[model samples]
Target: MTAPVAGTTPDRPLVRTWLYAVAIATGLAGAAAVVHQVTGRFWGDLGAYRAGAVAAATGDGNLYQASHLTPDGIALGFTYPPFAALLMQPLAVLSMPVAVATWTVVSVVALVAVIGLVLHQVGTPDRHRPATTIGALVAALPVFAVAGHLQVGQVGLILMWLVLADLVGGRHRRWHGLGVGIAAGIKLTPLVFIGLLVLTGRWRAAATALGGFAATVAVGFAWRPADSAWFFSGGLLDTDRVTGDPRTVLNQSLAGAVTRVADDPTPGFVWWVLAAVAAVAGLAVAVGQHRRGDVLTAVLVCAATGLLVSPVSWHHHWVWWVPALLLLGGHAWRHRHRTATATTVGVWVVLVASTSWVLAAPGGWDLHFTGLGLVYSNLYVLLGVAGIGVAGWRLRQPTGPPRPATVDTLSGSQP
Candidate 1:
């Protein structure tokens, strides 16, 4: 007789499962549409970019230039690099409403797909189906909200999915690296992952990313060398000041929070020192975990650390955590009765609640009141630190991988 697959176990009830998934997805879609129509924009950053691109295309001239109005300015289109502008060409051709709507839907779908894959990998037999659906739906709401609010996070969702897929042995690691590198060329923050690849001994993946970065820089320089110079000379430097402005409330980074707190100029050195120390420590921990063959943990820790340690980060950027969140949830479901499972669930609740509350808060509070953004930003930082701490503690514990004997006993085999 053929042997039963170990740990395959049982599945969830199909009918109820599908219904819940569909309802959640529909709700998210409706919310996205409602927000879009009411705001006359997708979300935050997205609205700014879509409007700026439209302005540029309409002969309104380069909106990133200082000559442009604050509402219309691209905020250093020069810093955007040519390939980024090139990537937006299609959207530039389309109407704002059409582009924003299309982008929102596509990003939402991508977020779902990534969550589904992560759930499948680590989910419990009973929870797999429901968790897959619910996680995706949960992630989608914030995803759509962010997109509708800022027009960012779509890239984040894509990058997170790509990195997870690659680490999970998908055949397209290089391609994913390339895509993320292009995103880095446009956004800068994604560059942190390159350090992760190197530290984790992924030489080939690192090479692929390096190649992609080079290619983007070359193409960008070739297309508009002057723009490249302008970007590096003025835009990158000015980003600090522009982002520090009280009106740009969307920034959720430690730097942004610090900027809001200072009455006059405080020592920038202090903030940089904190960020640097945190980053190094986080990277060391993540790399050590990766060396121990905990790819999922490594990725989760590193991704969270990247954002937490960055001098500048926005809430929309937190979208990258969807995969990690699902991974933690799936681990809980897979080991529902265990101590680790309880810890996982507790962390999930805290992180999810904190994130949801912060995202829903107004950007004005994020910009004007130092205390409000400080609370949100510090909450994220603390959670990230605590999570890595928990993960490290778990590692030190004597828990072993489930044994074949346990599987045999569970399956009612003679022992």
Candidate 2:
């Protein structure tokens, strides 16, 4: 079955009203919990970001060299680019509770905005779009995560929103691709989007992205020369900044899986080989979707590629799956695969609902896992790999040629 055109589905006002009510209740409750946790985590990721900015702004010490200990004894330092520290300088100015509260609200709004953006790109019509989006978010509760991230104060959703806006909403604009470059400056994962720009034949945008990224790098070097040099030179290689140990269950990257399976802390040749293969395969899937004229799916796969190939894809980074499944379920629903879609949604709910337990599994013991423990630990990575395979398999061997792939099929007004 072909995908449904925008006007094909009828809307139900009662359904929309109920979903809106549920969404508001659930979102506020979730935000409250997230804010509470963030407030309690004094030396957590927000702390790192704030501390890093205060260091850079107040000249306390080297941003790269500084480290703070958590209550549990894990040593974390400011690991993001110098540009990020500068950008986050506001965090250093606000009181901790106010900063955490404000950040939580901003993150929640960003995630909802990202969801709305994805739904728009997926061609969900205005009549039923709101219900469909809130329904999906409520169903995928963790991904909804209204006011905060499960990982506490991560900027991944904001970056996702920035990239999606550039790709889908700004497709026709000359300033396209600039958001992605700035995002990469904040966190390097979105850098893969520049390559997606190149492969999808947006060469000028690619150049603009590269130029924007270069400008950020130049700014970093200008403001914090020594820290910038250390980071750009070798500090980036130290995975401990973001991902302490590759073998840890929280690291759901291809290299992480390989290291856990191979029992190597330093994960050398095999990890590289696996990463290379996954990157190539995932990018191939993305390019194929582009050729098929589905820029939404193409951009998402490129995002997935970044997650899969990075040295350590923290479990929270897996939130990208929310928009992904929205698109995928749309395809399946239009195809009338009701049972398959239900099964997919059920699996997602079960896995994510148990995330608190799974995340807590690494608490008492060393990170080594075996047997089903390995599967339990790497479930997200496995699911991501499976998602790439399914996406590739769903495409026909040949569709209409590169039909000027654009993300504007039924995107309403920009979110």
- Best-matching candidate per TM-score: 2
lDDT of 1 by residue, 222-272 (tens): 765755666656666565534545223345455654565663234287678
Instruction: State TM-scores per candidate.
Output: 0.74, 0.85
Would you give me the overall lDDT of model 2? 0.72
lDDT of each: 0.56, 0.72
lDDT tens digits by residue: candidate 2, 59-148? 867997666567767767888889999899898898655566666556655666667667666556666766676677566556422222
Please give the RMSD to the true structure for each candidate, in Å. 7.2, 5.3
Q: Give the CA lDDT, 0 to 100, for residue 233 in model 1.
A: 62
Candidate 2: deviation at residue 280, Å?
1.3
- Candidate 1: C-alpha lDDT: 0.56
Worst 10 residues of 2 by lDDT: 402-411
Q: Determine which window of 10 residues in candidate 1 has minimal summed lDDT.
A: 403-412
Alpha-carbon RMSD, candidate 1:
7.2
Off by over 4 Å in 2: 1-39, 143-148, 354-366, 397-411
